[model samples]
Target: MKVVIVGNGPAAVSAIKAFRKVDKDSDIVVLSAEEYPAYAPNCMENVIRGDIGDDALFYAGGFSFYEKYKVDLRLGKEVVSIDNKKKIIYVKGGEEVSYDKCLLAAGASAFIPPIPGVELGGVTTAKSLDDAKRIRKWILEGRVRRVVIVGAGPIGIEDAETLRYMGLEVSVVEVFDRVLPRMLDKHMADLYMKPLEEEGIRFYLNSQVVAFHGEDGWVEAVEIKKLGSDRSIYLPADMVILSTGVRPRTYLVEGTDIRLHVDEIKGRVVGGVLVDEYQRTSDPDVYAAGDICSGIDVFGRHRWIALFPTAQQAGAIAGYNMAGLKVKNPGLVDYNAVKTRMVTAGSGGLFEEADESHTFELDNQIIKIFLRDGVLIGYQFVGLPKVLSVNKNNPFLKDSITFKFTGQGLEASGVLMHHFMRYRDRKVTQKVLSVIKNGALRSLANPSHDIPLFSL
Candidate 1:
């Protein structure tokens, strides 16, 4: 069997790994729109902050990763479209690839709003390696002194922290009332923001970017307005970053018969290609994973969580199913972690609309849990690495902690996600909550054991 995969990120590589385990004899061709190899998406900030070398961005230091895997790897090949009937893929340069089956893990792209002057030279998105290089260049060149980031989502918050760490004046403008609105509650958002604020980063919540102003085609400032008022203010910005988050890259199948779940707002493609639990799309021979697809959330509704781990899990499942192993990803609960030198935080599932919510705040950590009709709905946590773990200074965390870190080695958020994922259990979840209520979210999970499969 010749399987063609349309992507080069975590999802595509995961599919390759799983497929190899099941059917090594099948010919696997991986196509990447970028000239680079698979790199961790979350590590982009590390590169921008000059912690990791540029060459380290690509897995295995270069194309050697593909060579080692014994797969046909095609770089700089952007899949433009597909002929579902012929099972043929069309690249941007008119190249065609034929396959018995295909996987569309095309991933996502930064969402650029219709704001004017975005074409200015100093404006970029925090989405790709190229964008990271651009931002780093401006900072290293001393060309940017003040950076205005639009949106306080994960990317935006991270970029703000990175620029500030690099000694640039950073300001964030978020449309929502709080930072990480999708992942954290207003109170927990304050905790995450506190560190950045202490580092001198500024935040403008409940605000929107109106436009960019530039001279000589390079950004000079950004115009923003409070959501409830007509007054607008211009913030001086040597560079501007659009960190408004991302949308699924479902362009290749726009005219194809493959179905997509569209976001009602602006009629945009929200969920990319629709797929069953097996990652099989409407087209039987085609499967999808990563940001290019959506699955059921804890609420049994469709959601697109464009995180690296989510994509990786989805990719593995897609690969297994494609290789005839019959695995599945019926649904997922949101889980994510973000760490900087200053703070580590993460959240999962629903908030805002939960029927009952509880908060436990200590000098060392803060944890919030939400539920609807006695069912775990959502959660959030924020604190320093030491405080999140066994803290002798705090009575609640003296020794009961039995936790394992996840997602880029962030332990605090790992604790949050661990409890968040397993909290559905009648016994395990309540024990976790009770422990936190008494002292801290001491770990109930054994690091030696795998995350319970039921959590997925």
Candidate 2:
């Protein structure tokens, strides 16, 4: 059996290992456009912050691991086209390879807006290892004295915090009203923003960068338009870092027989090549994972849940089925854990500002939850440690459950009973009740199973 996996990120790496586990003698080939070995995309910001050195950013098991597993690894080679009918992939350097099965784990690219002067020097996005090295070099050389970041998402905010720590004058400009609009609600975002502001990071909310001004082929200032107002303002800066969101890298699949979902308003391919329960694409031979594919979420909606853990799950399932194994890949639920000065974790759904069906309370250190249907969909916690388990549950749920922080007087047994009863009644369905009950029984019997319910 011959298998070729594209993209060489987390999803591609996991697929190779999974194939080897099932059929050790299967021929495996990994293709990556990046010149270096595979590394975690999430660690790019940390590398800039100096939390991890350049060499430490690579995966723990590097090229030697692929050699030990007898997998062929190809770096700095781009897979340009996939011919599903012929089962062949065309490369950039006039090379072609045929595969018995292929996994398309090609990830996303950083989205740069169509603003004038965006091509000027000192403008970059943190998408790959090379991007990080360039940004780090600019910072260490003191070439970036005043930095302007163009997005307020998690990556942007983390970059801002790290840059401030490095003694650079940093500012963040976002078109959204609040930071992390996707991950957090206004109340939760306020909690994070207050601390970051105190750390000397300036934020310009509801603003868009219209153009960049440069001198001697380098950025000098940015012209921005405030939301709901036609007036514009100019801000001086030495460098501009685009921390805007990413779009799926689906261009290679275009013009092929593969069908893609296109959004008329956005004017780009919105979702991945559609797939069914078994991770089979429109073309049976081609399978996709990670940001390149869209799947059904726990809420029964088709969404692109692009996270590292979700990508890994999708890749593993695709690899198992591609190897001719009979396995059903359970779809993913929306879950994220982020830690700054405090820790916040949530799953399933977020209470957006437009969501009238949800009611929430935010006080000094407590978060109260309620659902429009009188069930609990979500909750947020700050400065409170005891209520951590109250928020954790199985990923799937039919109805919501309310959560209230009882004082420290609450007994541990009582808390466990509350969780178990909720899990038995509201969270788990009758079909999966036996599995949940048996797992709970095993967990209670073993002391080693008593792991912390949450971690940073």
Candidate 3:
């Protein structure tokens, strides 16, 4: 068998290894548009700030790992189109690669909203290593003084922190009422915002960028309108970074037999490849993973969530199934942990995503666990226990006084909650809380288990 993978990120890398594990003799080829080898895009911040060098950005030894795995890795090559019927992939240089199985882990591109003057020279997106390199160069040369970020999501907040660390005046504008609206609840988001404000990073909530003002083809100021009012304001900026999330690179499927999933409630076609539990798309010979594919949301509906770990797991499953292992993806769980201004905040599963919920707050720490019929479904946390003062009346505070959950806390919560979903017992919430209090949360580090958290 010959396998052609359309990306070289974590997904493609894992897929290659998985395929080799099941079918060692099969030929594997990876096509990457990027000149550099696979590196964690999430770690690009440290790379930009010089905390870590470019060499440290790679994972599992980068491209050399693929070479050692006996996979043909093609760098700086773009897969333009796929002829499913012909079982061939066309590359940028008019080269065609024949494959028995194709994996479209093409990933996503930074979404640049159609705001006016957005094409100006001073604007850029933080989607790749090359982008980080360019931004770092622009900063080290003292070309940027005042920076404006157009979104308040994780990427936007990260960029704000990094630029501020570089001594640039940073401000973030978000159309939502609060920052991290998708990740944290309003109250939790406000808790996370306090420290960011203290760090001198300005946030303009409920604001939408209408246009970018440019001087000599370079962005000079951003024109934004308050969501509910006719009032407009211009923020003078020497550089503009668009951290406005991303959409899957679905354009690669254009004219292929691939089918994009449609959002049932929104009545719009989802922006990713639709695949079954086995990660097989409409074309039997083609599979998709990573940001390019849609997976089960916390609500049990297909949703496009582009997170790194999910992409890796999905790719592994896709590769396994492609190798005829018949493994099934357990679906995706929403989880994210972001550190801004040296403070960490995390969320897992649902937040205001369900009907019933409970909230507990103490000092800088806040925990809001979502539940359905007495079973825990999700939770969110803002600070560490050492930073949080114990509240005597709060039952959840007893064991949490010195509790130190690892970074895996957020991702583990989804697993525990989902497992509890099977039992209809009323003690579901109490059982999960006990598990956390007994320090069993640490056991979630085991690779096999799905992993939760608080006092009842």
lDDT of each: 0.78, 0.67, 0.77
The C-alpha stretches of model 1 lying farther than 4 A from their native spots are 54-56, 262-269, 298-300, 384-409, 427-431, 447-456
Task: Report residue 236 deviation for candidate 1 (angstroms).
Answer: 0.6
Kindly list the per-residue Cα lDDT of model 1 for residues 61-103, writing each as its tens digit.
4677677667799989999988888999999988999999999
RMSD to native, candidate 1:
6.8
User: Of 1 and 2, which scores higher on TM-score?
Assistant: 1
Clashes of each: 1, 2, 2
Report the lDDT of model 2 for residue 456. Answer: 10
State the displacement of the C-alpha of residue 310, model 2, in Å, after optimal TM-score superposition.
0.8
Clashing pairs in 3: 412-451, 416-451
Task: List the candidates ranked by lDDT, beginning with the highest.
Answer: 1, 3, 2
Better model by TM-score, 2 or 3?
3
Q: How good is model 2 by TM-score? A: 0.80
- The TM-scores, one per candidate, come to 0.88, 0.80, 0.87
Clashing pairs in 2: 376-400, 376-401
